[model samples]
Target: MHENIDPAICPVCGGDNGCALLAGQPIEQCWCMRTRIPKEVLSAIPAERRGKACVCQACAAGSAPARPD
Candidate 1:
């Protein structure tokens, strides 16, 4: 996504879900529903932003590494 894209973009990869659910499909059909996002990785997000955005595929799938401190 370009600048001025979703601020809710993943803090890890700065990307969006682009999933069917996000496109107005059922939650059960969303890929994230089947995926397991690591708790430690989720903890890296700032408290204020927690639960505010969905981490992209890479972060959710553990492909992308932790963001530097």
Candidate 2:
């Protein structure tokens, strides 16, 4: 994770990431625990933001428009 990134925001689209851990919940309780983010989707995160914040469900599921490359 990037040192200055907000874990609660989606690195891809700047939206809520819905991360349970960031919300004071357990990792196992996060939506990501049950969802398998695709390689393409994961790769969409900017290099600087990669591993910093989670991608929101909309972006991960291909519903949200990705940031312009």
Best by lDDT: 2
lDDT of 1 at 41: 71
Query: lDDT tens string, model 1, 1-69?
Result: 333334447776666655665578897887778888899778777665566677777887778766553
Q: lDDT of each model, Cα atoms only?
A: 0.69, 0.86
- Alpha-carbon deviation at 60 in model 2, angstroms: 1.1
- lDDT (Cα, 0-100) at 4 in candidate 1: 38
Q: List runs of model 2 lying over 4 Å from the truth.
A: 1-3
lDDT at position 58, candidate 1: 85
Q: Estimate the TM-score for candidate 2.
A: 0.87
Pairs that collide, model 2: none
Task: Name the lDDT of candidate 1.
Answer: 0.69
State TM-scores per candidate. Answer: 0.68, 0.87
